[model samples]
Target chain A: MTESLQGARVVIGSIGDDIHVVGITILGHALRNAGAEVIQLGIQTPVEEFVATAVAEDADAVFVSSSNGHAAIFCDGVRGLMAAAGADDVLLYVGGNLANTAAADWSEVEARFLAMGFDRAYPSRTQPAQAISDLVADLAQRRSASNG
Target chain B: MADNVTNERLTDDAFHAQRETIFREQLGRAPYDLDEALAFSLENAKRGTVAAVLQKAKATGVAAVVPRAGVASWEGQRALMQMLDEAGAAYLPITIDSLTRELQFAEAERRLASSTTEVSALNGYPIVAHGIEANRRLIQSFDKPVIVRANAVDLRITAETGLASGGTAFVSGPMYATLEYSKNTPLSEGISKWQYIFRLMGIYSEAGVPMADDAVGFSQSGTCSVPALMHVGVILDALIMASQGVKHIMLYSMLQGNIAQDVASCLAVEQLATEYLHKLGLDDVSTYVASSDWNGAFPERRPDAYGLIAANVFAAAIARAPLNYVKTIDEGIGVPTAESNADSIRVTRYLMNLIGRQAHAWRTPEIEFELHLNLIQARAILDAIIDLGDGDPVVGSIKGIGTGILDIPFSPNIHVKGNVLPIRDASGAVRFLDHGALPIPAEALEMERERLSHRSADPSALGYQDVVDDLQFLELDTFDPATGTEVKA
Candidate 1:
């Protein structure tokens, strides 16, 4: 277990109409404090902007957050956008209060997001900082291995 | 699997131990069994019965309302609106989602604009999206105050959105840091996230805007040692964290099967928690009674009319809580019908207007009634707190206090009953404390209606099955032979 997040380029932002930001901000601060080069995309960013920012900055991870129950939509669009931008290999993380509609099977929800290429999916009320740090560290290790 | 189980247990114990540390460190005591603490509180309540929290809300000009968001179908929103309308309660309707694809927020806004219904837009749900400009624009589009829900996992978004939209308020939940606490995740990670959410809360509060911090969705269901106590602690911490500018923390208590041994048990927990908050110098914190009695009386069956009637009575018992925004009975059964919703309100209103006064002494320390209900629980939990030295109720962390047991357990359906992991280990021998009855289904309503409407007094009463058979045969034969074979499978 190495501290790979140090200087890792990570882009944190919210996608789609889901504008819940507290979780993301927390993640950003944690990542920054962990010594990551973070591009905080803020809330309600279009998919194109995220992809552009990631591509332009050559970021290691694309973290997306949403609080409204439609995490599936957020995950799907971000996955699609990442694919379109050929940044599909970037570590994709999705989280938020994604399912408050009917009582839902969140495991299935998590699987669905995973299938959409997210490395992880967080339930709403989940801690985002941990995920950000984990994603950064994992990506940094991978990057180091590939370059080393 | 066994290793995983053991590992999980270890994790949970660690979580509990950690929680106990926080409780002891902050509140300076060990956890008390919920029943005991609640008992203490009830004893105190008997000595003095305060006016219903709603009376205070009415008198104080402070409002505690839940922003209900409907599904894209808009039915939830509509139902919420109708309930508010009938209750004569003004509320905020915010559109929030964890998923925003397919939804054109602009289009939704446009449609919302067209409707004659009164609705003010807030950031809506999770508020987690990268559309910074879009989110900002959405918030800016609404002239009314917008609430920004922030947590450790989402502080970056909060800061950005706060800067962009000038966040007027914030809603923070306490379960966030414990995401990994109950899970197999590393302990360090959970601690860091916990610290992170706290930091975010501080930021939002220090920013000078009011925050409606949530106490605990964690205590009743998750990794925390004493869910209820921890929830109370978190809320108290949140109030203190707010450092004065914070408007009102919404204290939420759902009637899970386990929180209160009965309805009185439920109310006892409520009263004790509320009193605890009051003691914490958080006089401004408002409470809302969203009794998740979604499970009617029967845990095994659908909505029971009797259970519903009982829930109304229970609601009346803890009227002393800061806010009582009771959920309609039809919630657990299915989507509540408009008539059912009205019936629920009428029943609750009737209870409030009728028996509520005579029941004023309902919180008396001792449980005179053999039956346990919300009020009894309220009294009992209060007693538990008193036993814990009657110290101020700590909000965020439930480390040592036994009153933590008083936390309202959420429906098992949301936690363990469904696909979600069970809160406790299966092998662990635990007391099967009868919390209370859960709700039944809406179909039961039809069955009851049929039983009542078509029943006969004689031995040859037209039973429901008999009526269904008659209807089936009639449909099969068709009223007219010309319509024969028209009934497809």
Candidate 2:
């Protein structure tokens, strides 16, 4: 927790037809460097595939990246599918151009994803540093509480 | 995993034998007419051809501005080419549709037939679905020389269709198609696909039609394209294509924000490509340089977008590259209107006019340093790749990328190591933060690290945050002078 991600098993992918890979690619690289085990499903992945991979890898967390502005539709059944797969306890993170058009306010977009059952939803262009730092702190707190 | 036809240049009989099947079966319904298509290209080469336009641009000391645009219907694409031509575009581009790019001809036909909107359901013009006749009509509608633009592992169908349709030039190289577009295609397959395409191009050239080609095996490499990595790709792609008998070639340099590095990269592509081609005894092949405008985020504000586009044009003009691939102001939003695309050309033409009088090359100390760095870094990668292939670039590319010696940052290709990390230094020059297993000399790698450590915010260390910021660097509205980055982020 103090030095890095503490070997968190993470699964990441671009949902639907979104091919913009810069954001999650850097995040994956940073996660791997931070001592997390990452399985990258790559662009154009379906929600069911993400859930299946998460279950197969027994991933502690799953990060969904979308950049063609179709995340709202593409991520519709993500959490429900995870719950169906009995991986409801697994952490979910979502980010990248979340709307078709640039939003007047990004918070509404974040709230929309949050309501869909994501633990954390970052707005467009959020730095991997911030994402990693938040994940490390959150995982550490969660693990300690369960131990007690 | 190895095939008998692996990576090496295709023999004459091998190419024709494959072509009989490709032309006979690849096109859905359009009869692949070799004699007629070759004759069409030969006629089009008289006044409007990419190679001829570049030659004119070089002679006139102005960069020929070419913009990106395409639609599903013939009517829309014709309008785009004509408008850009009237606005002073030296050449035109027909971007192929995604389905056609992937060889999904039937799906592309469905989309083209069902598309009700003025804009295309498919992202680009479907070369295969439209077939040879419709594509020829679209190309012959405009006077400007046209270039076929499509990126994928398999381009046999698209390449043949475009050339046969009378387009004078073709875009993309093998290594580029695999890394940027393909998710599962092996690098060897990429090389073989291109060999087939190049052999087809060579046949056309021999049949009295001159064709232009380039090795654009990778895109802008986005934010941190260390000028050298791109230069090497162009050089290597050029080498492989020329081996197939392609005579006229162009080198594409991505215009990263830094003028010094940008100009140096423009110089390096010509320098390195010429040197490598000459070294390999392919001296008959002619080379021209083209620099593409910034391939990153454009400003949302209209005025700011115009300013950014103008600045990019200025750099390309200063370098006097034979061809300058321009970006539109409407890029930050959605699809660019014909007016906006024309407006970008007007801005580029004005700058070209203003700077066209002076032909003196800019040779500042910083530019010279970047040029030197580019040569060394590229040579390191190229030499390593060639050595990996036992003196064959085709074989070398596959082996080098597989081993991480030729690692490209941000590549989604499974074959690529993607271990190299590039980040902007304090002065805004791209430096390798993590060089991975690249066989570059230790001293040069250390130099990159030392340069990055000069960041004012934290001189001794860097983190993923810096890289994140660097990736978002173009999108930032303003820079915080103290942190050497944006205050907004």
Candidate 3:
């Protein structure tokens, strides 16, 4: 497949009090392999930092990860921050254990993120390649819609 | 004075009574009978208790090889254990699944049942979710000492289930569990909970049931070079276990890729642990060194990873750790197959036997020098902790960690300052780039600084990128020590 994500810059990190860096690092490697320039903020990044970095870099998307099961609490104000920063057009993605309860429904988690202004929400077990492919498609769609 | 003494006695009595009540209530939640549990464990035990296995190792001068392996279903776990046992594993491990580790029994139960059809449904054997009878069946299926391995901070219930169901040992220590696994857990709370687990072990010991407690070691700190920091963690845990009257304690250390440093660290841990326990007035507590093969990041290539594993196992064998925890060749790839697990055990056992036979010829001046340096550095860290606690290592550990006096680099725990950073010296031994608030002695600090200064002229360049590079150093063909840059093959 072609490097569809060529020249695209994506900002990724673990949000809030979550300090899981391995998953983000792995994802960063995968994204880079898929030809996306990944700016990894490492772990325990606040929502505002992600927005600020995305705006500063004029990034294509903001990818967030959380493994401490407090994603909802940590990612609550991200959409608002983006809107206030006037960067609401940036595509936002989140994945990993998104709630404290292990048995929380995935559909509910996705809906919660959607309501919080995330463009897409992946499950903890979603493959990095799959996430990157979807992000590429979504970015293409957003670009076409904006041009239209 | 009499009134004050009476009031203090009343408070102590009340606290003990409440604690006893809580313990009873927790125990009552499950259908656990100590006698029945002991009978089940004894019947299922093929290689006797963990203590017996270690004793055998000591008497025979051969290290016991234990491989970490578990699957979701009882049958899968049994198959895995049977493979390792047949391959000559002296001890077996029943690693708990993430769900069971988090105390989510229902999910673990569902996954355990589903794992029968879909083998990949769960990552480990959920001992608690499977209940006592299933655990008994799994244990009875194997003839080796089976230890329950989990990141259990509050392991009272887990320990009860594990011991009652034929697990002779459980892997965890308060500081290691709290700081390594549970990022938000308070060290004090973790210690109190572990005290209950230790009390349970003491009860079993009193009843003539052999039990062992393995403290989580510097293995959790990854590749960062802090032998003293890791040794102090082991000693602190040993002291806690001794305080709870644990008879057998295993002070574990991981292979940090340097033979002299790893050997020195292991020897120092055993020496210091024994001395510290003796000083604490716990002369009956027996301690042994249990070395784990390379707990750091592994190379992606299977051949390279196997080579690294073999090297680490050789180091552990040469170190003469009574118990050696072996990791499979497929560690970097993901969960290893049962055959790979068995292969790892066989390889480690062969190497250990070779080393044991050549024990008399295995003396080196370099090892002696490293050992002396490790002992001094470890003693300095431990002495500082004791001073911090006002003669109590336990109290001092809590205060030391709380105030960043004893810091672990790259710890996920928010409470940990994480300001301490470790970088490798010219010879690839770990040394602190930034000591942070570690209360190490001035001489030890100077020695570490001097060692690092020899590696790089610009020590200020040692920061986040250095750690990232060091974590993946094994994967690179050649690593530039000065810049921490990797040249791919």
Best by DockQ: 2
What ranking of all candidate models by DockQ puts the best one first? 2, 3, 1
Model 3 Cα lDDT, one tens digit per residue, A87-122: 988889998766433335678878988999888898
What are the iRMS values of all candidates? 13.6, 4.4, 8.8
lDDT of 1 by residue, B92-124 (tens): 333343222223434444433433323222223
Give each model's whole-structure lDDT.
0.42, 0.76, 0.74
Per-model DockQ against the true two-chain complex: 0.04, 0.18, 0.10
Which lDDT tens digits does candidate 2 get at residues B1-489?
A: 234334456787777677776656765344466788787778877756888888887887777888877777787778768888889888898887656776768877887886543645656788888878888777877777799987777789888889988887898787677776566678777778788888788888888777898667454554557888877778878998898878888888887677778778888888888888987788999888877877776666678777777666666666777777878776665456678889888887888767654525555788887888878888888888888878788777877777888778777677788887777877677777777888777667766666666774443466556766677665555553764655431
The clash count of every prediction, one per candidate, is 120, 1, 2
Error of 3 at B93 (Å): 1.1
Off by over 4 Å in 2: A1-11, A15-19, A27-39, A44-48, A51-148, B1-8, B20-31, B356-362, B446-450, B456-460, B480-489
Pairs of residues at least 3 apart in sequence or in different chains that clash in candidate 2:
B176-B217
Candidate ordering by lDDT (highest first)? 2, 3, 1
TM-score result, candidate 1: 0.40
Identify the superior model by lDDT, candidate 2 or candidate 3: 2
Clashing pairs in 3: B46-B143, B47-B143
Model 2 alpha-carbon miss at residue B333, Å = 3.1
lDDT of 1 at A140: 62
Give the Å shift of residue B173 in candidate 2: 0.6
